[model samples]
Target: MPGSSILVTTDKESVARRMESLHVFRLKLLSEEMCWLILSQKAFTGRSQASREILEDIGRKIANKRQGLPLAAKTSGVLLQDKQGREEWQNVLNNVIWK
Candidate 1:
């Protein structure tokens, strides 16, 4: 069976909820470049150590991206918005490490 078959089920609402959780990564509004950087790191390394480094890099980049924003203000939102964003996100997913 295909790998994607595991993600399929008869319950559409449950599937939609799962998809939403999987799709949305907490990201700052101006961190497009940082997101791409994380995506690239994730694409290259398959080892557990490399995975930790990639997550660390992502967290660090998000911290840096939040530097200019207000002290009291916190921005949290989905990583992808429209069709183009979804396409780009899927391209990243296609190259990711699945350990």
Candidate 2:
């Protein structure tokens, strides 16, 4: 919920199909900052949290790797939610397949 509260899911292929078919939803690529905010909210909020400030250090790398996709950011946050420490974060960061 960064730029617009409305959520839509589409990549290149899905967008093309949407255009040709129903065209009900519009697809927009999120900004890196927006993705970062999303990941921050996901990983560091409510019942589960470690040091929330750690989000700042690894955030840029994480957001960049997500390619401004909210789904990607959310998925990544889920992957990391129960983990702790720089080692875990760095593992996610260094893994090319994580992208």
Candidate 3:
């Protein structure tokens, strides 16, 4: 006979309390903070290797967006690319910095 798997409750509060003894609380907090830092860097291409990369990237993108005569829109695409890079850089920063 095959063993039956148990169905655990999917409640957020319950899950959080259970994670206290399992040591996942700290990990979750770190993950959240890292995610915030990464997602906030939707500029500058997020290429920096530090937690503040998002802030720096945002600043860079703003600067880049301002580099033009008559307000050319050539740098718009760079903003999109930088947004993606910011997400990736977040993961890298979290894994390398927090790990």
Candidate 4:
């Protein structure tokens, strides 16, 4: 097995420790801007410029509540994908999970 390599990714420290001599690199959390970018890309693909401007502030708030987690932002984006109203986005920002 000369010049052969295998790459494995895991979030659990226990799993990572089971293998010796493995190179480990930790991933950094997303920034607020990055989270907003992901959410906007997922939820507002065809939204109008005016609509985007109207919702941008609330969207940033929602993105901030994601706590720099990409998965959280992606999930929120999916939840808002079909919603276009400011109230709908505001409702998400007001959700108890962010409390």
Instruction: For candidate 1, write residues 7-70 as lDDT tens digits.
Output: 3333245655766545533334445554444434433344355544444443344334443332
Instruction: Superpose all Cα atoms of candidate 2 onto the true structure and report the RMSD in Å to 1 decimal.
Output: 7.1
Q: Candidate 2, TM-score vs. the true structure?
A: 0.71
Query: For residues 47-78, what per-residue lDDT tens digits would candidate 2 score against the true structure?
Result: 33447665557856887789878899998877
Please provide, for model 4 over 5-84, each residue's C-alpha lDDT reduced to its tens digit, 9 standing for 90 to 100.
87767667677678763677778889999999999888877888898889889999999999888988998988888888
Ranking by TM-score: 4, 2, 1, 3
What 10-residue stretch in candidate 4 is worst by lDDT? 13-22
Candidate 4 Cα misplacement greater than 4 A, ranges: 1-24
Task: Go through the candidates in order and give each one's C-alpha lDDT.
Answer: 0.38, 0.73, 0.38, 0.86
Q: Native-vs-model 3 lDDT? A: 0.38
Best by TM-score: 4
Which lDDT value does model 3 have at 22?
36
| TM-score, model 1 to reference | 0.20
Q: Which ten contiguous residues of candidate 1 have the minimum total lDDT?
A: 72-81
Which of 1 and 3 is the better model by lDDT? 3
| Candidate 3: tens digits of C-alpha lDDT, residues 1-99 | 488543343326667576553332231222333333333334334355564444455433433333331112223324334445456544433443222
Candidate 1 achieves a global lDDT of 0.38
Clashing pairs in 4: none
Backbone collisions counted per model: 0, 0, 4, 0
